[model samples]
Target chain A: MAKYAGYQSSINKAVFIYSPEQLDYKFSDTHPFNQKRLELTIDLLTSINALNPSNIVKPRNTTEEELLLGHDIRYINAVKMAGHGKLTEKQGEPFGIGTEDTPIFPNMHEASAKIVGATLTACDYVMQGLSEHALNLGGGLHHGFKGRASGFCIYNDSTVAIKYMQKKYNARVLYIDTDAHHGDGVQWSFYDEPNVCTVSIHETGRYLFPGTGTITERGSGKGYGTSFNFPIDAFTEDESFLEVYTTALREITDHFKPDVILSQNGADAHYLDPLTHLYGTMNIYKEIPKLAHELAHKYCDGKWVAVGGGGYDIWRVVPRAWSFIWMEMTDQALPTGNLPKAWLDKWQKESPVTLIPTWTDPENLYDPIPRKTEITEKNQQILEKALLPIRSKNSELI
Target chain B: MLIEEIMKTKIFTLKSDNTIKDALRIMRANKIRHLPIVNDENNLVGLLTERDLKNALPSPLVKKTVENIYEQNLEKLMITNPIVCHPLDFVEETALIFYENRIGCLPVVSGGKLVGIVTTNDLLYTYIEITGATRPSSQIEIRVNDQAGTLHDVTKVFTKHHASILSVLVYPDSQHEEKRILSIRVKVMNPLPIIDDLRKEGFDVLWPNMPGINRL
Candidate 1:
């Protein structure tokens, strides 16, 4: 159990889940799924005096039993063996290990379990009422499957943490993924369970990897009408991104009425992110968490657990975008003007690309997208299609 | 792949003497569209489809209800001597039959006995599997000259990166007659290294391409 520094009667007592070991979830020095963003994000928050030790909590290691809630025992054994160099490449192939995306690293199982434990810790804090909200920058490996690793994710921390909440606290979880890629692993985990609803708003999978989050992928069996997806066009700007995000999130929360909200905050949708093509600015990052914070209080009794995900532009986009999530969680006023001079001075020399100087992005971040109107109109159609079930049900009631 | 491997062996069937009402009840209960009409010796005699049943029934807007329509024998409406496929036939050959006949399903016959059935849905799913969209993977397209050993040259890059190839499809380039587009889906998320190697080797890689964008 994490040591809490007594209780203050503050309305927004948010816990930031962190540990130096969380940085151990590294694939390679040059790999795009870098954890150095976590360090940079924490340093930025520290420099602004927005986060301190009392508000920071160290993550625990996830146990084998808890891991079994989401992963198969055979896959877990394979991961363990691969971490120790006992498993051969052929042996690891079926389990999606030793591949280019998730290469075998020393003690990988421990590292991945620690990230899962971090997300579970955040869930415990929020669900147990130790905090109104919690943020685990190490978690949100949303592409990890039950028996396979994918998209640079080894073990899906979000899915395990949601299952932990379901078993330990009996809480109905509403998972919201804002990653540039589809949150397929977490969505499929509870595809037939009515108690867990997943909503992912991402770039369309027409040309992207892991291409499946269509509007037609509503949940199955008893969980029908519980899954929602909004695949926006490639060049979607911040205004259009947030329009679908806010509308779908608000209506879904109203319909599901979940006991807690677990959000995966992947900051890679920015224009600077190399992997995806969405034109999201820092504005969407600021608004993404604000709505979750408000709705957690409204529908979930202020219970919210957040985790970090795919943000490849670690130097330029990730740190600032993630820091905004923490600031929102703590109910701090959104920062404005130039970034902390000390933080920028420390990171600029190390960053290859020039960092954005202001808390807000510069005007006209890229050449104006040629088909902005058509993209927005298409996204609006997708939003309607995704919400059709709930809309029809509400009309039937009326 | 053979039709026996992909066909659904456990199928619903009806005898020719069974009433149309029996076929309708079985179709509704099983939620199946096609039924093979078999004789006493379990030989496929005819095929009954949901479309035939619907055409035999009275329309929803009709004021006069026809009482004798449900009591009619299925043999009167069934497609006698319908085109049937052999279980030993290649799946590709079976698919061609579907397209050429403009039919939705084909019952698999083995030794003059009804054994299995395959529908257009099954064939479409087989296409999806062959395209490798069911797995977690990334797709890469390369334009190569329509010559031998182009596939060998291109796949060498994936082998270098230790990436497994899930599926490879070859199609003629619409713009260039001598060029062919090789769409390869590999079971890995980050294809940057492979893409880099292909570019370094002077291969034209159209990775996640969009319209109105230059291939640079």
Candidate 2:
């Protein structure tokens, strides 16, 4: 593997925060949000020799006290009861479980707590200078609310991790999410805080689940101008997706200049992802982490923490897309040509669909979008609106 | 929903003789746009809005004016005998009145007295809540024949799955005049099973019937 572009070849610049227990946060075998993506991604990294065994860190279970940072006491108690099969479907309904979305599963509380702790572990590694960057692929449950779970998210790891950073380190954190769906839980968590800045670029709420990420949702009260949402139109391809992503992220980061950066990397925006309508390919994933690496070094002294979010195409899309972040963070060049034949040969049999055995997706992922011109224009308009507060503030200083 | 249920009852009123400055102060302090002018007996006389004040006052670019418009009498600017609604009036009718009259607010009156005020913002928020976009839910759309019992037929599938329906709306299909599109937002994120059930029931479940669902 070649060293990444314009980066020093450090032995361990980032840590792989994971434990097999994170896989226990499963809903069901047929559920779209599968932790099997985590296994595939780890294998891809390991096969390329990009993931260092010395840097892999096992996570601890989140203390009930830490879970309290981002959840209601009653919700936590209810989750505990439901985990042991003591809570009934009727009792779990009000808490957003046992529904078609998040049906009750065994040991859900223990599993969710481990994911939360993994995110916090990554945060601690970066904020405490133990590592320059960290990746917790099990975290990024962005739809979990204060008391309810939605969108297959049980306990919002990113929300708890951000609050933990604030309370423990007193660090001004910047959260960046590029999932196909809106990061509603994390956005609303710090909607009124001035210190934490959240930026989400997703398919517009008009056609996505948990629809509430309009540009008008800028942080309220003193937190005004801190929250930014770039809800691009559906069927947005890689070029347009990267346009809004790179521009908004750079502008928002330049304005906020936080002490640390936390990115929620959800690969569901891929063209093959059955859940989302976005047409992003592996191209956007390459730039997604490259830019995060550049900005973390530029602003936060390489203090970056990333977590996984909503990606349904675990077999065909998520493995390749998520592996880019580790490669970028570890200063390893994006693998080209065929993936390690051994990795593909092993996983292909288990994969329901054929894997793209190469570094790049096919030239023609889908038919050209008819509304490409109009969608790009509408996305540009949203980008301008989302940047208005920062632009005006910049002009005021001038 | 009725006017009284969602209307802001913490009334802010000013006497008819009050100056434009008084109205501006009240609106600025409370961040309200509409204010009702009441008589001594608390009967609604006129209404004043931020827009009317803006029109009456000189522009900020105009540094000097011979007469200060802020001190002008409210009687000269307030809309006299402004359209009002009853406290018991349906919100939908009030919304229609708002659209038909091209007005921003309607003062709720009962027995010929000022009760409360409802604004365009309030009505829009009510609709937002009714649409269930405020909650975390996944939406699905199905195209069905433009006939009665179609909605019932579609909802039966959702009922069998015990999926809580947040909101259900009927929209006209743009290309097919003989068909109607039924949009439903359900509380569950994994709407796959319900969508599958709808499709098996012979309804064309659009999954995400939107600007991009059929285009690409």
Candidate 3:
């Protein structure tokens, strides 16, 4: 238990990242992603008296210079001028502000910048050693790229944070992403960088949308053997999820010895999520921050910054899962007690058709993943192929 | 009911190069009093406790560095052989070991390797009664291609036998990729053997416990 102190106190030091400006960031009314989701979490924490204003920090906007750290300069300029305006040309496809997934609402640039700002603030807290842990639920836009945006994400907060940590602190960073979808944007940006060890465990790209987390996509040049991907089959549950993550995390963290860990926590992998087939519930989501916090403390003297990603079941699941994240960060786990009457009353008024569960569903419905299955075997082979050059090389320049 | 339900997966371990002070820091962080020291190979070497650290410290006047403290022959401070267990250790026996030795934790092992560690807290967490101790008298065995939800059919058979399973363990058959052997222990009120009853119900009862299997 003494080894847990690194995490215990670190988890206690988390600063909840938010901004009143988050209300301007809604994508569409048809989509479940909106500002009220964050408000619900704040309300829940406030009602439970877990909300400490001292621990809350408003997000900071990234300057165009910092934005250029991972993004194209032209892209930044386009976003600034667009300002909730739509982009229709295929050349502007990467800047997904005009598409169906990413609509150009009013204050589009400002709202996206706030999300990036929240994550950037989280990174600053960890980098400066002011706080060992911080979380921004509005970030984790893992699918964004340097010149383009895809998958309902605009700015790649994780990539920007990584660049900031590297450029500012000169510290070795281990970026572990736990979002359901592939961390394609983050991966592509650091695919050739050595100082950053990227390990992503997600549902196999096959049989899933935007499928890209194949095992064979290991980094090239000096960054060989630095990128690791564990693409598990669809419908994976809690136990198997834990197994794969534990194995990957233990090995990768030992190999990397990171100075700070930036994790993209996406709650969309929950069984209730409409988009994914993975079956983890609130328990798994809750367990992750605790483990990540523990591991960060153990490996990196408790330096960690967690950002929220893709979770669409706003009223029913996202708020609850992230609240558990808040609870984990505070070192006070949310109990099985009934949801506060006031919160539930407000939740019903917010979403009329959704059924709010009183307690966390116990079943993760997990089973062992077959290592020898054709799909897994094929994926392992592909990953091995991608990582072969890395394994053979000695050092990768970041 | 079984140790599998209540074992901690993360264990507290120290590398050899780490000082006794370092070990103590880890122990304090985890709120644990014990640490299992391992070499680079992850092989267990010795155990250190808070008592060892206290004893190793010198008098107040002689301010010594941590390296100097270790150089003062503190090698003799650790407990050499600590008790360990497999992940599948029975809960009753594990609890007995804790009581008998007055130890709070048992480092779980698999294939002579450290897979996880289970403490009293883990035992307590697993003891939450979601359902009563339902034991099965009928031992049903089957061979089929191992796939997800393969046990669903066998679970259905147990439901028909009016059996409540107390514990279940799966062991893979060495020669077959498609086959796995599962043993289900169930709780039954009647002394009458249900092995034959399950066999009559078309289950392949290859291995049945002899009458009077130890309950505790």
Measured by lDDT, the strongest candidate is 1
Worst 10 residues of 1 chain A by lDDT: A1-10
Candidate ranking under DockQ, highest first, comes to: 2, 1, 3
TM-score of each: 0.93, 0.93, 0.59
Q: For every candidate, how close is chain A to the native chain A in TM-score?
A: 0.98, 0.97, 0.87
Q: What is the lDDT of residue B56 in candidate 1?
A: 89
Every model's DockQ = 0.48, 0.55, 0.01
- Worst 10-residue stretch by lDDT in candidate 3 chain A? A363-372
Residue A362, model 2: lDDT of 85
Q: Judge candidate 1 against the unseen true structure and give its global Cα lDDT, from 0 to 1.
A: 0.90
Position B212, candidate 3: lDDT: 25
lDDT digits (tens) for residues B65-146 of candidate 3: 4567744422467677778887677887898898899887776667766666777776665653322121112223344457
Q: Give the Å shift of residue A391 in candidate 3.
A: 10
Backbone clashes, each candidate: 0, 0, 27
Q: Model 1 in CAPRI terms: which quality?
A: acceptable
Q: What clash pairs does model 2 have?
A: none
Q: Would you list the C-alpha lDDT of every candidate in the order shown?
A: 0.90, 0.88, 0.69
Candidate 1 C-alpha lDDT tens digits along A234-268 = 88999999999999999999999999999999998
